[model samples]
Target: MTTLYLLGSAAPPVLDIASVIERAQARGYDVCLGLTPSAARWLEPGAAGLERLTGHPVRSGYKAPGARDVWPPADVVLFAPATFNSVNSWALGLTSSFVVGFAAEAIGKGIPLVAMPCVNSAYARHRAFGRSVAELREMGVTVLYGPGGFEPNLPGERRPGGFPWELALDAVDALAP
Candidate 1:
């Protein structure tokens, strides 16, 4: 089976991560879910359900010292509803969380990566945002954004279901050999 790590950030779309997991499974992906620290807290209500769905713990932090790694190394990684903070942090090589850490290392490991950033139009206009997207793309990470990917949402909008998750999955399919 193709092992995929689905990394989620703290955003409105995080609530719908189960669908991503379900979709990947339908596509024959052995999916493991990883959440940013804040995302994990938001997902607390359904944490057990998520674990049951994937048959693995929804990991947010590193394992105990010298402890065995439970999850397998990812064949590909998809970061959905990636926050503005996580995008910039990943570009700047910040491993403050397990999700970002995996992103940083994945680049060097040559593991295929796809990212979908969820930000409002105001935040998307920031100079660093474009630069970070460019930087990630230059690293060969498919940072899904712009016209066909994730478009910036209007400010103050609670548009939870608007995230284009299929684009992320399509990126994965396109990248796969």
Candidate 2:
């Protein structure tokens, strides 16, 4: 079974995550989730439900005692709806939380890492953000920009920008020898 780690940002649009996971599973991959603190607020339909759907535990935070051990090295790591904050943090090599920790460890092991950046135009256009993304790319991380033409809402209705599911799955497929 191919192990896939799904990393999500805080308050990601519901449609974005649901569609990404559904598409990945459809391609016959085992999926696990690591959510940011803010992401947990939007996942209240129940993390257990997500786990049931993927048949693996959905985890968040590092200091959750037993939860820290749930993270396993994965074949592929994908961050769907990646926030500007998390992107910067990851770029700076910060592993303050379980999500970040797992990402850092995965990258260290040369695991394939992909991210679907979901941010407004201002954040996406920031010089620092661009530099950080470039740095991650230099480290072999694949960062997919959101598809153009659709404006995302600020307060709510965070539109699912690009359909990054295909790109994510392709990364996994490359690992299958």
Best by lDDT: 1
1-177, model 1: which lDDT tens digit per residue? 888999999998989999889998998898899999999999999999999999989999978889988888799999988999999999999899999998899899999999999999999999999999999999999988998889897898865667888889989878754
Judged by whole-model lDDT over C-alpha atoms, candidate 2 comes out at 0.71
**Count of clashes in candidate 2:** 1
- What TM-score, over all chains together, does every model reach? 0.96, 0.81
Per-residue lDDT tens digits for candidate 2, residues 1-177, read 677888887744434566667888887767788888778768867777787777767777664565445545587888766778888888888877667777777778898888766677777677888887788878887777644312334543444544445665676666532
Error of 1 at 108 (Å): 0.5
Against the reference, the lDDT scores of all candidates come to 0.91, 0.71
Q: List the residue pairs that clash in candidate 1.
A: none
